[model samples]
Target: MKTIRSRSDRWFDAVNNVLIAAVGLICLLPFLHVLAKSLSNQASVMGNKITFYPIGMHVEAFRFVFAHTRFFEALQVTLLVTVIGTVLSLTITILAAYPLSKPEFKGRKPILLLYVFSMLFYGGIIPGYILMKALGLLDTIWAMIVPLLVVPFNLFVCKTFFEGIPESIEESAKIDGATNFRILWSIVLPLSLPVIATLGIFYAVGYWNNYFHPLIYISSVDLKPLQLFLYETIANTEELLQEQPDSVRLSMAPEGFRAATVISSIVPILLVYPFLQRYFVTGMTLGSVKG
Candidate 1:
């Protein structure tokens, strides 16, 4: 059977499409402009002539950034924290989420309420700093990973998704003499790939872009993450440029450096997202559906 749309329906569809396209351009144009600025020559960048495309193509900014020792060190730090933090966060979230998803678990409500409560409130920065100091975690890489190990909202999302899985699968595994660990390892994880990939992206992005925690806890120049390094570099560019010998400063494009730094920091997540986008969409749909 085929149904035909009325003129009014067609009009509404046209309007919706226009609005969605406008919204997408709004989100996309800024990145394009930044990319243009990053790649454009210093003269055009400083003149603000580059918009969505490079006016005079150049790669000097990228070369300068790649050659900088501080940038390389900070990039390494960000990668380490992102990889290690995402793995730890996923493992801990899964362990906690699986147990909480079980209806027969005693104190589940209380435990869940505790998680919800944490989500609603936080000890302010002073207390968090004090606690980090007490634990001797400040100024170290663990300082980046430990404080944000498990996000409560993500935990609940995973738990809710886990609960949506049919109990019969677990029962069948049990009947086959599979231990709970075995069932979770072999049966549950394979089926939960969508959610796991989604959560991994979430955790990776969070850790990758985190600057506030690093700003507060890290003091060593060598220990700062890429985001923090970028922040400091941008903020102190004038002072640093003034200190540089005239020949070096004359060649460096501050605006191009800034744009390149922004691109470098964001490009990793942009690269990773497209690959996981299908799983991300599927996971969100399944996780949102009430079982």
Candidate 2:
């Protein structure tokens, strides 16, 4: 059946669409400006002639970024952390959440309360650094991966989603002499793909964009992640540009190099997001609304 909309409804829809489009454009404009600056000629960039579009297009900025050895090293470190961290986090979260989702599980309430409490309160930065130091995780890649393995909010979200699963499905599996682990592995996980994908993206993005923990824990230049590398590049653009070969320095402006670094750091997450976006809303809504 087609529903008829009143004139006011039409006006409201028009206004809402216009407002949303304006907000999206507002957010997108800065990124476009950065992209333009990265591609524009040094003279065009220095003269403030570049806007949303490149005034004098060139790939020199990108070529310089790609040729930098530190850029690849940081990229490699970030990729390792993101991939390994997401997998480990999802495993730990699923294991913890599964037992908590079951009302019959022993000490569920206390354990859950602890998670919630920790979520609400945190030890300060110094305490966190001390803890990492004590654990011998300082200056190691594990320093970045271990500390964020189980986010309380993500735990609760997973637990709630698990609770929403119908009990009858598990009972049928049990009647067939399937073990709890078997049920979870063969049935529960397969059915929970949306939530998994949603949480995977969350974990991946967190690991990818993390800077503070790495800044404190990672003293070694070799272990610094992409975000930290990008920060240093932007903060010391003039020095970094001067260090570059004269050909590179002549080919790209400091602003162009900074813009290129920014773009390079964000591209991985941008590429990954669209693939998982279909599941993101569904998982978040179902996981959040159930309990």
Candidate 3:
């Protein structure tokens, strides 16, 4: 059987499509403008002639940024933190969530309540810094990695997904003489790829874009991440321009340099999304369905 739409339904569909397209354009246009500025010649960029398209296009800004040694150092630091932090966070989240998902686990409610409570409250920046200092983590990469290993939200999502898995599979594995670790490693995790990828990207993005923790705990220039480096670059562009040779300054505008750095910093993370896009929606949907 086929159902026909009324005139009002057609009107509503048209309006919804228009609104969604408008919102998409709003998010996309600003990025296009930045990309234009990065590629536009210094004269066009300074004169505000660039918009969604480049005017008198050139790649000098990218060239200048690529030649910067400090940028590479900061990139190295951010990469290290993002990779290590994501792996450790996913490992801890899975470990903690697995036990909590099982009803037979003792004291599960109280432990879960503690996690939720901590999520809703914080000890403030001063105490966090003091704790990092006391632990000898200040000025080290561990300061960034250790403090954020377990996000309550991710833990809950993993727990919900684990609970959705059929108990029959685990029981079958046990019948084959498999231990708990073997069941999780060989049976459960293999079936939980969607949720794992989802949480993996979440942890990766948080660590990559994290700025406040590094600002508080890291005092050494060598340990600064890409976001902090970009901040300092934008904040001190005038001083940087003065330091550069006259010929170099003439070839690149301050705004162009900033735009180039912004694009460069984000492109790597953006590249990661497409590969995981297939699993993202499925993971979030299935993970939330049970709870």
Point to the candidate with the largest lDDT. 3
Number of the predicted model whose TM-score against the real structure is largest:
2
Worst 10 residues of 3 by lDDT: 277-286
Q: Taking the tens digit of each residue's C-alpha lDDT, what string does model 1 give over 16-128?
A: 99999999999999999989988998889888898899877887777766775388899899999999999999999999999899999999999999998899999899999
Instruction: Return the lDDT, model 1, position 54.
Output: 88
Taken over the whole model, the C-alpha lDDT of each candidate is: 0.87, 0.90, 0.90
- Clashes (backbone N, CA, C under 3 Å), per candidate, total 0, 0, 0
- Candidate number with the higher lDDT (2 or 3): 3
lDDT of 2 by residue, 1-291 (tens): 999999999999999999999999999999999999988998998888888999878778888888864899999999999999999999999999999999999999999999989998999999998989899999999999999999998888889999989999999999999999999999999988878888888898899989988888999999999999998889988887888778878878889888888888888778877777776676557687773
Arrange candidates by lDDT, highest first: which order?
A: 3, 2, 1
TM-score of each: 0.92, 0.96, 0.94
> Candidate 2 — which pairs collide?
none
Error of 3 at 236 (Å): 1.0
| Span of ten consecutive residues with least summed lDDT in model 1 | 281-290
